[model samples]
Structure formats: C-alpha cells, structure tokens
Target: MRLPCILVLFLGCGSPDQVQPEIKQLNEIPLNIRDKTEVDERTATVNDTLPEGWVDVKSLIPELVLDIRYATSDNFVGIQLYPCERCLLRKEVAEAIAVAFEALRADNLGLKLFDCYRPRSVQEALWRKVPDARYVTNPAKGSMHNRGAAVDLTLIDQNGHEIDMGTEYDFFGEKAYHTFTKLPAEVLTARRKLRDLMQEVGFKHIRTEWWHYSYQIKNYEVSDFRWPCPGQAL
Candidate 1:
C-alpha cells in the first residue's frame, strides 16, 4: 500500500489545484495501527524554525496530489505512516523539495513525493504488521521515516507518465534493490537522474532503495518523538 505516485500524461502550464481533501488534516490514527499509546522515548526533538531555502510544495506541484498515509504493505511494511500530526517534519523540507522541483521542471520533469514526515507512533503500528526480525525496524530502534528527513519519491515526464524505475514503489525484493544487475541501462539512468537531482537539492539516498532519499536526517542520530502534524492554518 505505498502512497500513490501515478503519473498523469498531459501538457501546458496550469495553476496548481487545491490540495486533496483526504491529504489534509491527516491527524486521525487509523484503526489498524498497533499501540496508539506507545511512544519512542529515545526520539530526538528539534527547534520549530525551518531552515532557509526550503519552500512549501503545496502550491508548487498541486497537480501531484499526496497520499501520505498508512499502507498495509508500504515500504518497511507498516511502520512508516505518520503517527501524530505535528510529529512529522517541519514544512521546510517541502520547501526544499519545491526548489528542487522548480529546477527539475525547467527541463520538463516533475517530482512526486510518495511519503514525507512520518510520526513515530505510526512506525510502531507498522511494526505490529510485520514484527519479523528482518523486514521491519523496532520503534525502540528508530526509523529514518520517523524523522522529517526521509522521503520516497519518483519522476514524471512532460506528459506526466511516471518514468519506470525498474519496479513498483516499495517492492520488497531483489528487483527493488537499486544495485540489481538485471535492470536495463536506460531505467538505471532514469533512476540515477532522480537520485542526482535530489542529491543536488541536498538529499541523500539510501543504498538499498533508490526511490528513498533524505534531506536533514543525516545530522540527527535518532528519530523524532511522536508529536502532531503542523496546524492547518500553516
């Protein structure tokens, strides 16, 4: 159940649409989340201020709707959903992405943020879905997704069709491996383009998953403690 990144094929510059209704005020804890009360004690806390150069993407790529919610089988199983509203990353990360989008769009390309700023509580719920020692990270251990730093993303062409990245988002197998030798050269190049562009905008990708990247998570040694998402008025 990875977030939807379905690219649409179209053209011409158009004003961005209103953010999707289901995508906003995403504070309710889905019923299936494991322990709503369990909080990560070791999580780190940060100042409320956003760094410079980061711009909110709500208006930048409004055509690319966000579905940042729990998935029965999203990456890392179910542990990466936003646990609390405020607990997600500050808005600056989205801003940074918007800047990156502006640069990418100049070349007729666009970005699709599959996941961003997850709450630690949602990570706990994800653990319950697949508590296996191999696939999921224990909330007690911490997850990059729990921090505002990590994001799952992909690219879209001018026509809006998503460029093939060799496998579906959150495909949990060898095919999903960024280094899989079986992938074609062209697909690999497209993957690298997304990776390089994100990196240029100050993001770093995880070795196993090319679609996953981080902005500020590299500086923090721990995930953020569960909190709430930013207020709607923001």
Candidate 2:
C-alpha cells in the first residue's frame, strides 16, 4: 500500500518551471538568533545532552554516517553555514530516521544525512545569497528544516560510498527529480529505494529533490533553535 503524502501549506507556490521540493510564498522575517560566529569549530560535539524536545540523530543511531554538507564548504552555498555538524530533529522525526537507517542496514546499504534541522539564522544567510524560493525556502515561512521535520540524505553502499543518484545533492535541475526518468536504470532504482524507505517510515518526499524527505506524522512550529556547539553559548 502506498503511504500518504500530505501537501502541507508549506509547499512553495511556483510555476511549473520551478523545481523545488518545498516552495512557499515569500514572507520574509528578520532573524533574531545568533549567526555563524560559533561554527568555526566544525566539530561533531553532539552528545546525549539535547534540548527539551529535540533528539540528536547521532544519539539514536550512531552508526548512521553523517555527511553534513553545510558544516563544510562542499555544499551549493560554498561556505560553512552551520556552527557544527549536529543532526537534531524533532523527537518523532528523528525516531523515524533511526528506523529507516536500521532497515537499510539489512541490505548492506545505509543512510548519510547531508542536512538536518537548519537554524533560522542560517536560513536567512542562505536567503541572502540565493533569495530565490525555487531553491532556498523563505526563512519567514520556514522550511521543514526549521521545524526539525525534514532531512536531506542519500544512500550508501556496503563500501560506504554514495550510490549514483543521477545528480549531486544540490543539483538545481530536472535530473535530480524523481519524475525525471531519462537516466540509467540503476539511478532510478536507487532513488526509488530511498524514497520507498523514507515513506515507509512516515516520511513524505518532494518532487524535485530525490534526497529530500519530511516527516509529517506530527505537527510542529518553526524554530530558531540552533544546536549547542562545543564551547559556545546555547
């Protein structure tokens, strides 16, 4: 049976040419949180200690590899946006991620998250650089990342290498879409596997990004909460 994918109001209103997983009408907001003045550590200091309702994915499934792109300059932003590499999600969302990870391990394939629980301040930073809603979700409406309900991830093989998924993580083209099937059979199968696994665990996907998934089983508000970095004030 096919799992349900509720198109929440957060879906951005874009033309058919626009290819974003979550696009919303622009509702800009001023940021009131700390910026990247503390991200230089680039350390993964996340531990069992967490916020009241958040759960660190590392704590739940330590074995799941983290390829946090924003912590490094490898992402499309081309700069370090995160204070550190901590994949904190809402309690239930993180649990669903853990379930997906274990299920993938049964086949020697695993999960590696690229982005999770982005800070509102960072969202503003991204908007400043690429204020287009087709790629960056407006910080005002707040993407699933701000709500700790979304994840950007890819599948890894038994050798721990990311399998081919037609395009890179942040490719802004039709090739990265799940509906774009003019590619190798293996790439399509890989995308389908990741999507199926995420949906099975109560996560929903967007059309334009194969690696994007949001857990919508529960409702939550957008937040400006940045994860506590080592030697930094929370």
- In terms of TM-score, the best-performing candidate is 2
Model 1 C-alpha lDDT versus the unseen true structure: 0.53
Q: Name the regions of candidate 2 deviating beyond 4 angstroms.
A: 3-48, 231-233
> What are the clashing pairs of model 2?
12-23, 12-24, 39-83
Residue 38 accuracy (lDDT) in model 2: 38
lDDT digits (tens) for residues 36-79 of candidate 2 = 33321221234335566787777656677898999999987899
Question: lDDT of all the models against the reference?
Answer: 0.53, 0.74
**Model 2 — which ten-residue stretch has the worst lDDT?**
25-34
The most accurate candidate by lDDT is 2
Candidate 1 per-residue C-alpha lDDT over 122-209 given as tens digits, one digit per residue, 9 for 90 to 100: 6677678767534445878776666566777788887777789998776667676655647788787787677556655556666566
| Model 2 lDDT, residue 185, Cα | 85
TM-score of each: 0.61, 0.79
lDDT value, residue 6 of candidate 2:
24
Q: Mark the regions of model 1 whose C-alpha exceeds 4 Å error after superposition.
A: 1-56, 59-64, 69-88, 132-135, 217-234
Candidate 1 to truth, TM:
0.61
